[model samples]
Target chain A: MNTGASSTRRRHSGRIVTALLFIAPWALGFLLLVLYPFAASLYWSFCEYDLLSPPRFVGGANYRRLAHELLNGEGFGRAVWNTAYYAVASVVLSVLAGVGLAVMLSWKVRGQAIYRAIFFLPSVVPTVAAAVLWMWLLDPGGGLVNHWLTAVGLPAPNWFKGVQEALWPPDWWSGRAAFGSKDALVLMSVWGVGNFMIIYLAALGDIPKSLYEAAALDGAGNLRRFWHITLPNLSPVIFFNIVMGVIQAVQAFTQVYLVSEGRGAPAESTLMLSLHIFLAAFQNLEMGYASAIAWMLFVVLLAATAALFHSSRYWVHYQGGSP
Target chain B: MIHDKATFRAHLLLLSAAVLFAAPLVWMLVSAVKPAGQLTQDPYSFWPREWRWQNFADAAAAMPFFRYMRNSLLLAGGTVVGSLFSCTLAAYGFARLRWPGRDLVFGLLIATMLLPWHVTMIPRFLLIKELGLYNSLAALIAPTFLGDAFSIFLLRQFFRTIPEELSEAARLDGLTEWGVCWRIVAPLSKPALLTVGLFQFIAAWNDFSGPMLYLSDPKKFPLAYGLEQFVSSYSDQTHLLLAAAVMFTLPILVLFFIAQKSFMKGVSTTGLKA
Candidate 1:
């Protein structure tokens, strides 16, 4: 009996060792790539460290500078506002557009697969290529969009050139600006809403047809049925899309970098948080300040995510009980 | 039958949306074949007056297109091999083993996905530089050997779906844990593995920021970054630019067509499960 017990213990220890061996690569990466860098970034946020010199502790200075700039509404403040505008506007629009497209694609129509493929194709285009294509498409002069607008006797806003006239014309049009780079960015984002549409399409497939049939039997029209049955069933996926959309919009950089000509030009109107942090660290060589901005962005994202989760209980419908 | 009017309206809306979404890409392709003079003079033309099929050749000549393509393929291939090797092993450990603190460690792995890349960008860059990989494609590819959080998570999920009886049977046949993972679990998870590989390939192909950060040498620039460089210099050559963009995008578009099922399944599964 003692021999049997000892043998089992030995086997258990062997299994543990084998497991460790299997996990070694990821553990090493988690430590070196993730954990160490995470700690270093937080520490660097408080220290002035250029690539050339050793870090010098300067507590609160970076934060203070960011706060000052944020209040002054020139540098960091512009970025914050621009990021907020882009993230909020793009996320809301994409969610709406994605759901609409997904529903349309889900309809029992001829050539459904072909339509879905056409819609999904754009999202697969590389970000750099897409940005380049859009830049040409939205060029102020000698562009197809402007030419079409001119042919149709409509006003063609200088898409990448003008400062986005806030609230559009007839409401709060300043007359000094037209649809600007951010608006163009929103258009690009909506164009690639296919990714989110795919998720919604999957969720829509999971919804039972009986619910829709019952709603129809009650004399409910298409819109009413969608509002009652489809909307509720889709709430969970909608919630997921909203959370992911916000996060992705906040991190949007490559397209923005390309569109704004790498410096958020045309009046800094398209400068986003990620681009701002990148320019701060890489361009200006202010690693410390950039780290601070990154930390703030992290905190804001966390809070926003947490708040969304909290609010989701009331809105997001679950088939089973809520977790 | 339910509502002919509603269905008709839906098809109409979907067709128009599809056209709107597809117009830019179609324009990119159409403009690529347009002569340089025709592009500026008649930018709104749906069809080119003169088919300048040689523009693609011109664009290819304008840049080190072949070199950039080679670098891109190398990076993508390296990343796929690295991610598959490392992530599969790690995922097996997480899914099949019963080690202490496994759940907690797995939680940490998932949480890593939530951590924004910006937080770790600077220090990671410095770390890569310290490792003497800076300015080389190795700087970008080396990290993939470690493992990625998303790929590991994906593989783990697939591994968990595999029946434990298979592993046990292999073990009873005197196979080691590694043997069981390699000979049993890996074979059953081909679809998942393919999903991970496809994702890694697309990511590597489309990677802009990695090259932007780690690589400064023009010789090592992948097509994604190299194409951007071409843009800055050849901004006036719109037809060439469009041709170049089309060239860069064509392979990915074709891959999407071939692997559409895997791509859609991977995306949808990740979303639903997450």
Candidate 2:
């Protein structure tokens, strides 16, 4: 009995050694890359630390400036509105477009593989290349989109160059700048909804066909069956997508930086929070201010995510329990 | 008859959407070979009046195309090696073992995925510079060798699906934990490992800001950043720009075509499970 207990203790210690050895890479990374950076950024948010000099304590000044900009709708304020608008608009549109495409692709067709390949091909193109291609396509003068619009006798807006918005045009809104830079970016994003479509397509396959058959026997039409049967079953997936879409949309940077030439040109119209943070820290050397803005954005994201979870109870139906 | 009509409508909707999505790529290909003068004179022409295939030669010659290609390949290959090495080990630990605080640590890993990169961008850059890695590709590639949260999670999920009986049998045969992880678990998890490598490769390939931040020397620029420079200088020569863009984008498309099954599987599994 005594020997068995000692052997058990020895075995437990062996497992410990093995576990530590295996996990050391991520453990060290967590300490250096994640833990230290997290604490340092939090502390630096309260200090004036440019890269060249030691950090000096500057309590609340950066936050004050962010607040001032938020009210005046300048630096951070304009970015806040732009980020909000883009995140909401892009998520909603991609959901609609992705689901629409997924539903269509799920139908039994002659060339299903061909159609799926074609739809997924565009997304495989790298973002920088995609941005460059879209830039030429959406150019206000002599571009393919504008050329077609003019050919159809519709107004051609200066995309990537114009500051006007289609959703909330200002009082001085002219028909000329009907669609603007953010609108153009949103259109470009929807073009690459292939990832979302693939996910939704997979989920659509998992829905039991028997449910549809029963619904049809109960005198349900196609639209009714889709609304009552398809959507409820798919709500959990849609919710997952909404959460991921928001996070990705918030982190969206490369395309925004590319189209705006890194300065949010044409009246700061494309200045997203991510790009704003980039320019502030790297370009202007305002590390303290950038850190503070990052903290604020982080807090806002956490809050928005919490709100989404809170509201999801009313809508998201998990057939098997919490996903 | 009704089902036939519905199917026809679905085909019509799908065909129309495909045309809309495919038009930009088709335009890029056609634009790449257009006579340089036709762009300014007849920019709206749907097709090139004459295919000046010379534009492809011009695009390749106008920049250090081969040099940039080499840099891109090096960067992408380095990341694939680094991430696969680290993520597989960490995943085996998390999936196949039981230790105190293990579940808590795994939860922390999941939480870290939601923390936006901007929050850590500044200090991380400073950390790299402090390590004397500024203006070096190591600054970009070294951190990936440590581990990535998303890949680790994906791999951990895959490892858990592996049978524990194999690992136990290996242990009975005097295999150490490292041997079990690398020999038994890693080989069995090749598809997931390939998925992780594919993902890291694509990310390193698409990464614009990393090179933009850390790399300043023109000699070190990858194709993604180099092509941007090409655009700035030769913005007027749309033919050359389009040709270069097409060339830059082709490798990724070809890779996707070759790995389409695994690539689609990776995406769907991550999406559905998450």
Candidate 3:
């Protein structure tokens, strides 16, 4: 009995060592890449640090600056408004467009696979290339979109060069003013709505056909059947898309950076939070201020996500149990 | 009869939507071959007056195109090798091994995925600089050797699906844990490994922000960043710009076509699971 117990203990210890060996790379990474950075950023948020000099402790200074900017409509204030506008507009439009496209694609039709493939193609285009392509397409003059609009007897907006004052002009407001750079960005985002559409398509596939057939047998029209059955089944996926879309829109940098000429051109109309942080840390060399802004962004994201989860109880549908 | 009519109408609507979705890509391809004069003079024409294939050569000559391409390939290759090696081992540890604190560690890994990169961006840059890897390709490639949350999670999920009996039998045959992982589990997990490899490859190839942040030298720029530089300088040369963009996008498009099944499966799985 003593011998068996000793052998078992040895085996347990050996397994533990082996496990550690296997996970060593990730363990090292978690320590250096994640944990250290997380702690350092939190600490730096309170101190004034540039790369050249040692960090100087300035408790609440950074936070006070951010608060002042937030209230007085400075750079950070502009970024907040821009990010909120972009995130809300992009998320709402993409969800509506994605669900609409998915429903259309899910219909029983010939060449369905081809249609799906074509729709999914744009999302695969590299970001830089997509940005470059859209730049030409939305060129204020001699661009294809404007050319088409003119050919169809419609007005052409100076996309990427105009301001947002004309997005929803009142009927009494009659001017030749065009949609602004952010509107141009919205158009570009909706063009890449294929990624979310793919998600909706997959979820749509998982809904049992029996449900549809049952509704049909109950004398439901197509609209009624879709409204009663499909919408409920799709609520979870729609919710997921909204959350992810918000996160993505908040973090949208590369394309925005590319389109806005890398400095939020056209009167800072396209300055976003991610770009603002990047410029602060790298361009302006204000590491401490950048850290503070990053923490604020983090808190906002966490609050938004929590609010979503709170509200999800009222609407999100689950098949088996509460998700 | 009513259903048939509805299906026909749906087909028509889908066909039109497909055309609209594909129009920009089609425009890109057609415009790439248009002469510089035609682009300005006859902008609305769908077909080029003459196919100026020489525009590709001009674009290539305007920049160090081949050098950028080589750098892109090297970065993608190195990142794939590093990610596959590190992530697989980490995944095996998390999935197959029985050890204390495993569940807690795994939860931490998942939580890290949600932590915004901005929170770690500055310090990570400083850390790489401290390692004396700044402005080098190594600065970008070295991080993958550590591990990634998404790749590890994907591989761990795959590893858990394998039968335990095989590993148990391998262990009873005097095979060590490494042998059991390498000889038994790795062989059966080819699809998952391929998914991770493909993902890392595409990510590295299309990575602009990394090269932009780390490498300042024009010689070190990958195709994605280098092409953007080209755009900033030669934005007026619409034909040449279009050609360069097409050249940059074609390889990724071809890769997607060749691996469409795996790509679609990976995308759908990640989406549904998330």
Using Cα atoms, each model's DockQ against the true complex is 0.67, 0.67, 0.69
Fnat, one value per model: 0.77, 0.76, 0.79
Give the per-residue lDDT of model 2 (tens digit) for A163-188. Answer: 87775544335554488899898998
Better of 1 and 2 by lDDT: 1
Stretches of candidate 1 exceeding 4 Å from the true structure: A165-177, B1-4, B272-274
TM-score of each: 0.97, 0.97, 0.97
Per-model TM-score of chain A alone?
A: 0.95, 0.96, 0.95
Best by DockQ: 3
Worst 10 residues of 2 chain A by lDDT: A168-177
TM-score of 1: 0.97
Model 1 lDDT tens row, B144-165: 9899999999899999999999
Interface RMSD of 3: 2.1
lDDT of 3 at B34: 94
- Please write out the lDDT profile of model 3 over residues B154-214, one tens digit for every residue: 8899999999999999989999989999899999999988888888988898888999999
Question: Whole-model lDDT, candidate 3?
Answer: 0.89
**Per-model lDDT:** 0.90, 0.89, 0.89
